[model samples]
Target: MSTDASGGEATGVPVTVTADAAREALSLLEGEGMDTDVSGLRLFVQQGGCAGLSYGMRFDTEPEEDDQVTEQHGLRVFVDPASMNYVGGAKLDYESGLQAAGFHVENPNVESECGCGESFRT
Candidate 1:
């Protein structure tokens, strides 16, 4: 839940959500480019995909009691305790370009991503 620059906490285990990355996630939600009335973004990890783990996300109006709430650049994000381990030391970003567009993750745990980058293995 706590981390410093370079992503290493006191225990040496990286706590995801860099301050800069957290800020980017917020801009994607309420920024001029977003098209949803999302209250906050939820980050989760699921099994399946070419790799063994997959990333899933959605907008939620309310967060669960056990969810961890972190904010960056005024944008709030809800991370479930279960998914925290997998997504720890990761970042949330929005990619917009002629070929690729939408939300992307800069996950440190990720070993490799599928061709489309829709899935990854840790």
Candidate 2:
């Protein structure tokens, strides 16, 4: 899978990953025994949740033919065209705190999110 630089502005990548997120993703990929060069995290939007849309993510051996792949801190992220519509200009971040610790998507496209914060509506 080909990859563009982390800068979304230069590459027109829909989503960008924070340094913390990239580090966590790379560690996860290594733990799974996936080749960092060929494998990546897939970020996509799905129809579900309390609101109209929700985000989903998983590890992929490679990006799909139509995926927009971006590289950040040596970690690759794959975003599909459909998902791009909802997540464009979004930031993927990783936070480790006493209350929460995981990946989070800060999407500018989101108009509103559900009370539970599990879903969103554009």
Candidate 3:
């Protein structure tokens, strides 16, 4: 995979991370105090959101066989092939503010988002 300021340019990489998100991810990973080489962040889309789909992310030490792994700005991100359809081409950002604080996803494929902004429909 070709690592860029935005994210990796890999064939199966479903989502891209903004520079802000990448920096924040690196900080968060460091905060966990795990070996950076083996630990990474995993992003996925799952069923059962108010709008039919929800996004998920977590730190993982091992990746599944079907996962598409990419590294950018010293952060590793993994995305399973099955979740790519819904999140492909999406951009991830990290925002810290009084109103909202966390990772945000801007997905081009989303047709609608729920009122809470926690779920989406493709």
Order of candidate numbers by TM-score, starting with the best: 2, 3, 1
When summed lDDT is taken over every stretch of 10 residues in candidate 3, the lowest stretch is 1-10
The model with the greatest lDDT is 2
What is candidate 2's lDDT per residue for 1-122, written digit by digit as tens? 23433323323445788999999999999999999998999999999998899999999998777678877788888888788888878999999999889999999889999997779999
Write down the lDDT of every candidate, Cα atoms only: 0.65, 0.85, 0.78
**Segments of candidate 2 deviating more than 4 angstroms:** 1-13
lDDT of 3 by residue, 1-122 (tens): 43322343446445677788988988888898966776778889998778999999999875666667776667777777778777778888999999878999999999999999889999
**By lDDT, is 1 or 2 better?**
2
Residue pairs with colliding backbones in model 2 are: none
lDDT of 1 by residue, 29-86 (tens): 5564553333667888888887777888876765676666655545556677777777
Regarding lDDT, does 1 or 3 come out ahead?
A: 3
* Residue runs of model 1 more than 4 Å from their true location after superposition: 1-38
Judge candidate 1 at residue 37 and give its lDDT. Answer: 36
Work out how many backbone clashes candidate 3 has: 0
